[model samples]
Target: MSDQGSSTSTSQTDGDFEGELDEEVESEEGVKEKGRDSPTPSLSNFSASLRAVIRIKQKYQAMKKRRQEMVLGLGAGALVGAPGRTSPKIFTFDGLTPSAFPTLSSIQQKKKKRRRKRVLFPTGGGRKAMPRQERSRATYCLYLLLAILFLQVYNAIENLDDHVLRYDLEGLDKMLRREVFGQQGAVDGLLSHLKDYLSTYVHNKPLVVSLHGPSGVGKSHLGRLLAGHFRSVVGETLVLQYYVLHHCPQEANALECARNLSSHISEMVERAEEEEKIPLFIFDEAEHMHKEILDELWQLVASKQSNEYLNTIYLFLSNLGHGHITKHMLHNSSSISMAMTASGRHSNLLKELTPILRNTLEKLHPLWTEADILPLSLLEKRHVMECFLDEMTREGFYPDHTNIERLAGEIDYYPGAEGREYSQTGCKQVVAKVNLL
Candidate 1:
C-alpha cells in the first residue's frame, strides 16, 4: 500500500510540472505578439509633421497680418486722396494677372464693334461700351474732373462767413442783461421771449420768430444771431446788398421796388439751396421795410405761399411794436384781414413774434392800451443788466461798475416817437452805444 501511494504522488508531481511549462510558453507568445503589433514612429517622420503644423500656423498669421495692412493702407490712401479726387475709382495693382491683359483686349474689341454700329460724333457707345484704353482714360479724366469739383466745394464751404454767433440758451441770461441793463421791463420781456423761442425750437415746432419793440432795442443784433443759428442748422447765404426804398433811385416806383427786392430774395433763396443748403430766411430791420416790401415779406413768411421757393425758417427783426401787430390786424382791411386770418395765429402780429410775446402782451381787446402791454419791470431789467455784464466780462470786454450803472440809467431815460419811450429809460440806446463804443 505504501509503494502504491508513493508512485501515485510521483505521477501527480510530473503532471503539475508539465502544466507549469505550458503556461510559461503561452505567456512568452503573448508578449511577442504585442511587440510585433506595435511599431514606433521614426524621428524624421515626426519632425516632418511638426514642421508642417508650424508652417500652417505661420502662414495663417502672415495672411492675417497682410490683410490688416492692406485694409489700413487702403483706407488711409482713400482719405488722403478724397480731397484731390473726384472720381470714385481707385488706382491699385492688387489682383492683376497676365490673363487680365487678354480680357482687356477683348473689351477693346467689343468697344470697336460698338463704335462701328454708332456713327454719332463722340456721342455713341456711352462710357460703359468704351474700349479698355478709352475706359482707362475716361476713368482718369473723371478723376480729374472730380478733383476739380472737390476743390470747388471746399472753397465754397470755406468762404461761407456770413454767419454771426448769437447768444444761445447757454448764454441767454448774460445776453439779456447786457441788452436790457437798466430797463428791467424790457429785459424781462426780451429774455422771456428768447427763452420761449428756444423752447419752441427744442420742441421742433415751426417758429415765426419776430423781434418787435421800440427802435434801438438790439432787435437787429438778436435777429442776426437767430438767423445765423438757423443758417448753421439748415445752411448759409450771403446778403451782398439789402436796398431799402430810401436807398433806391427816384424812378423806382413801389412796384419796381417790390420787383427788385423779390428778385434779390429769389436769388438769395436759390443760392442758399445751391451753395449753402440753408433753408431759413432772416429779415433784419423788417420794420424799416416799406409797405410793398412788407407785403412781399408776408408772402415769404406765409408757409403756404413761398415755402417751396424760400424753404424758410423765417425770422423778422422789426421795430414795429407788439401793439401794432395786434391792433393793425383788427382794422378790417382786406390785406390785413387776410394776413391775420392766414397767419396761423389769432392775430397777424403773433405770426413770428417771440413766444414771450404771447404771455407778456396783453390782449388788445377793444384797442391798444397800457393794460395790453406785458411790461418788463425794473427788477427784471436789473437782472438782465447783470447777465449782460457777466457775459461781457467773460468775453474779455470788461466794464467798470460805474459804467454799468450809467448804462442802466441811460436805459431808464430813452426817448421815442409818439411820446413812447423805451419800456425802461435809456436801456435800448445805451446798450447799442456801448456795443458801438
Candidate 2:
C-alpha cells in the first residue's frame, strides 16, 4: 500500500510539472505575439528604408540642379564667343555652383555688384555700343562713302578726255535748248550766273569766275562752252584769248621777263579796247596758276586802256572736287563775295573757302543778283524726244514717227531718278536701233 501511494504521488507531481511547463510555453508564445503587435517592433527596418528613399530623392535633385547649371554655363560661354558682339567675353565665377546664385535671405551677405568691364573695339580707341538698326545703317553708310571715295581717287588719276576750250559758241548755243528745244531747265542754274556776270561786269570788266568740281564732272566741258560763247558774241575781230599759264622760274630776276610778258598783255588789252568786242580771258587749270602769274593777271585786269575797256573777263577753270578747292583757298570771307555764280547762302563749299577769297566773292554779289537762269527742272518726255529727233535728222537717218514715239514711251516708263532717269545712252541706243531697222 505504501509503495502504491508513493507511485501515485510521484505520478501526480510529474503531471503537475508537465502542465506547468506547457503553460510556460503558452506564456512564452503570448509574449512573442505581444512583441509582434508592438508599435515600434519594426522601427529599425522602417527607418532604414525611409532613409534610403530620402537619400535617393536628394541625389536625384542634386543631379538635376547640376545638369541645369551645366546647360546654363555652356550657353553663356557660347554667347561670349559670338562674332560682332563687341562686348567682351565674361567669365563668371558664380556659374560654378548653385549656392553662388543667392536667395533673398542670403542677399544681404552678397558682395556689392560690380559694373561689367567695357570692351574696346580694335579699330578705334573706345568701344561704342550701337543698336542693331543703327549698326546696320552705319555699316551701309561706311560702305557707300568708301565706294564714292574710291571712284573719286580713280577719276583723279585718269586723264580728262574732253578739253574745256573745244566746245565753240555755236555748239553751246544749240545746246541751250532752253528756249529752242526746252532742255535748258536742266542747266539753267549754271547758266544764270554767267548771264548775270555778263550783265553786271560792264562787258569789258576783266572777270574772274572760278569753276571747280571733281574730275570727269564736266567742268572742262563747261569752260570750253563759255569761252566759245563769248568768242561768238564778241566776233573774231577781238582776240578772245585763252591762256594755260605754265610754271616759270622761281628766281626773282625772271620776274622782269614776266613783266615784259605783262607789257605784251597790256598791248593786247589796248588793241582789244580799240575794237568794240569784249576781251575775255579764260585760264585753264586756274588752280595751278603760279602766284606771280595770278598777281600779274590781276594787275592787268586793274590796268585800263582809257575808259573804252574797263576790265577784261577772266574765267578760271578747275577740275578739283568742290571740297578740295574750298579746303585750300575759299576760307576767306571774300570768297563768298567774289563768287559771282551762286546766289544762295554759303554752302559747305563756301564755309571751307579761304576768308580772303570769301571777301573778294562778296564784291561780285551784284552779278549773282542779275542771274537769269534758275534751278534746272525736269525736261518733258516730248521735248527730249524732239531733241533726239533733231540730232537723228542731222544724221540723215529719219526714224519713223511711230518708232520714235514707241522709244520715247519706253524711256518715260523706265524707272530712274533725276540725272539718270532718262539716260542719254538709252536715247542714242534707240536711234541706233531705228537706223538698223
Candidate 3:
C-alpha cells in the first residue's frame, strides 16, 4: 500500500513542473510581440508631427508675400493717380479694398459748391441785394493831385513868357517911336529884331545889325540912343561904343587897335556871361574901320568862337550904301510915303532895299554878308525941319516953326517926285544951327 502512493505522488509532481515551464514560454512570446508593435507606432507618430510643422511654415510664408504685394500696389496707385482724378476702379490687395484718397480738384469743387450755396441763400432769410460801389476818398484825392499838377505846369508856362516881359521892352519901343524920326521902316526893323533877340536869354550866335545910309541920316544918332538905352538897362560896363576915328585914327595903330578890340570884347562877353546879361557893342563909322579891326570884330562874333560871345548885340554904322539909298529914295519917294502908312508896303520896300544895300556893301568887304542890312533913306524937308525944331527945343530955345523951316531950307535938297524935296544932309547941321541960336 505504501509503494503505490509514492508512484502517484511522483507523477503529479512532474506534471506540475511541465505546466510551470509552458506558462514561462507564453509570457516571453507576449513580451517580444509588444516590443515590435511599439517600435512601428512611435515612428509613424514622429513623421505626422514633422509634416504638420512644414505646412504651418508654408502658410506663414504665403501671408508675408501677400502683405508685401499689397504695399507695392498702394505705392503704385498713389504715384499714378497724383496728377489726374482718382481712378474709379477699386484697388484691392489680397481681396481687401480700402477707401480711395480724395483728390485736390474734388476738394476744391466741393468747397466752391458750398460757397455758391451760401451765396444763394442768406442766413438772414431772403437773398440780399448787391452792394453799391461807393467812390472812395482815394479817387477824389487822385483827381485833386492831377489838378494841382496841371495848375503847376500852367503857371510854369506863364512864368516863362513873363520872364521876357521883365526886360521892359514896351518902354524901349515907345522910346524909339518918340525919339527916332523919318526912318520909320528902319526903326520898325530894329525894334522887331530887338524883341526877337531879347525874348530869350539863350542864343546860338551874336546878332549883327549893319546900318547903311548917308552920314547925316541919323545912323550915329541911333547908335547913341541904343548905347544910352543899353547902358541904362544892362550897365555902362556892358555897353561898348567903338569909333574908328576916335578909338583908332592912325593906320599904324591898326594891329594894336585890333588886339585891344579883341581883348575888350572877350572881357565884356565873359563878364556879361557871369552876370547872365546881354552886351551891346556899337561900331560907329564902321566903313572907315581897318580890315584888321573889322576882322577882329568878326572873329569875336564868329559862331566857332565861344558860347560867351553868343549873347551879344553888335551894331555896325556905315556910310557905304548911302549912294544906293539916295538913288532909291529919289526914285520912290511917293511910294515910300505910302509905305510909311501901310506896314505891308513898308516891309516890301525894306525887302527891295536890303538886297541892294547888302550887294553894295559886299563890294567893300565880305563881312557885310553876315550882317542884317538896314538902310536909312534920305530925309524929307519936313523931317529935317522937325529935327531942327527938336534940337532947338533941346537947347532951351524958343519954339519957332518959321526959324526951323528957315534953318532946314539952308541945307541942300534933292528934287524928288510929286513936289517932294529931300534933304541932302539930314539933320547933320541941326545941332550947330541950334547952338548958334
Candidate 4:
C-alpha cells in the first residue's frame, strides 16, 4: 500500500505542471491578439517605455564614472610609493655619464691649475724692490743735474757785462787825467758820458757833447786831443775833424757848406756801421758855422735819423759862451775850486754853469739845445804857468819855474774873488810866448 500511495502523488504533481504551461501559452496569444486589434500605441504605454530607457542610460553612465575613479586612485597610489624606490640613472647619447667624460674633467683640472699659478707669480717673474740706498743715490744724481743747470745760467749773466772791456776805458781815463791839466771837472764830466755811451752797442741817439769856454781855456786843445785819441782807437778813417774856418770858410756858400757837411756825416756813419765801430766827429770853431751848416749837423744827430747814426760821437767845440763862462768863474772862484776838489760836488758846478752856457748858445743857434753842454772855467795864474812850462818843454827849452812865472805874468788877468787872478787869454798865447823865449 505504501508503494501505491507514492505513484498517485507523483502523477498529481505532473498534472499540476502541465496546467501551468498551457495557461502561460494562452496568455501570450491573448496579448498578441490585443496588439493586433489595437493597431496604435497608447500615451500611457509610450511614457512607461520612455521611462524604462532613461533609467537604463542613467545606470550605464554611473558605471562608467566609477571605472574612471578606480583608475585615477590606482595611479595616485603608484606615485606616492615611487619616492621609496631607487632612481634610474640617466645617460647621454653616447651612453656615458656626464662627469665620466675625459675632455670635461681635463678642462676643469686645467682651470684650477691656472688659478694656482696666478696666485704664486703675480708680476710675471716676482721682481724685488730696489734697495733704499740705491734709490737715494738716484735722487742725488737728479739734484746734481739741477744745480749744474743753475750755475750755467749764472755764468751766462756774468758774461753779458764783459762787452765793455774791449774799449780799454781804464787807459782812456788815465790819459785824460794826466795830459789835460787844470780841467779836472771837465775831464770827469767827459769821461762819465763816454763810459755810459760806450758800455753798450745799442743806442737811441748819438752822443752830442758841446765844449764851451774862452779861447785859451783849452777848448780847441781839448778838441784836438779828442780827435787824436779817437783816431788812434777807432782808426784814422773813422775819426773826422771839421774846422769851420778851414773846411767851410765864411767866404764859402752857405748852402754848399751845408750840403758838404751833410754828405760827410752820412758817409762816415755808413762806413762805421759796415765796420761795426763807433765813429767820432769833431767840429771846431762851431760858433763861426753858418745857420745852414748848423741845421745840417742838427739833422744828422737828430733821434729820428736812421739807426746807423745812433752809434756815433759828436764834439762841438765853440767860443760862443766864453764871456759868460769866464765871468761866472771869476765871480765864484772860491766856491768853484772847492767843488772841483770834492768828487761828490763836482757835478754841482756843472749844474750851475750848464744853463748859462746853454742860454748863450741857444741865442746863436737852436742846434745847441740838444747838446750835452760842458763849460770850461777860466785858467788861474797857476794853471797858466803850468801851460807855459808844458809849452817850454815841447819847444826843447828848460821849463824853469822863474821863466814860467814871467811868461804867465805877460797874459792879462781878471782879478777874481778870494784874491784869485785868472788869465784872460788863458793858455791861448802860451805857444807864442814860449816861441819868443
Best-to-worst order by TM-score is 3, 4, 1, 2
RMSD of each: 32.5, 30.5, 22.6, 23.0
Candidate 2's C-alpha lDDT? 0.48
CA lDDT of every candidate: 0.48, 0.48, 0.77, 0.75
lDDT of 3 by residue, 144-163 (tens): 99999999988976865775
Query: Which predicted model would earn the best TM-score?
Result: 3
Q: Clash number for model 2?
A: 36
Flag clash pairs in model 4: none
- TM-scores, one per candidate: 0.36, 0.34, 0.66, 0.64
The clash count of every prediction, one per candidate, is 22, 36, 0, 0
Model 2: weakest 10-residue lDDT segment is 368-377
lDDT of 4 at 362: 83
lDDT of the structure predicted as candidate 4: 0.75
Across 1-437, the per-residue lDDT of candidate 4 in tens digits comes to 32333345445644654565466456555655665688786776556556655754565466456544544454345446354324422222543586676787699999999987764334566675453453668789999999999999887656435545555667777877766767888888888898888877789988999988887888788778777777877789889998888887765588898897788778988998998879999999888888888888888876498888899999988888677776776677776554247344446657887887788778887788888998777777888888877778888998788878888888888763687888878888888878786
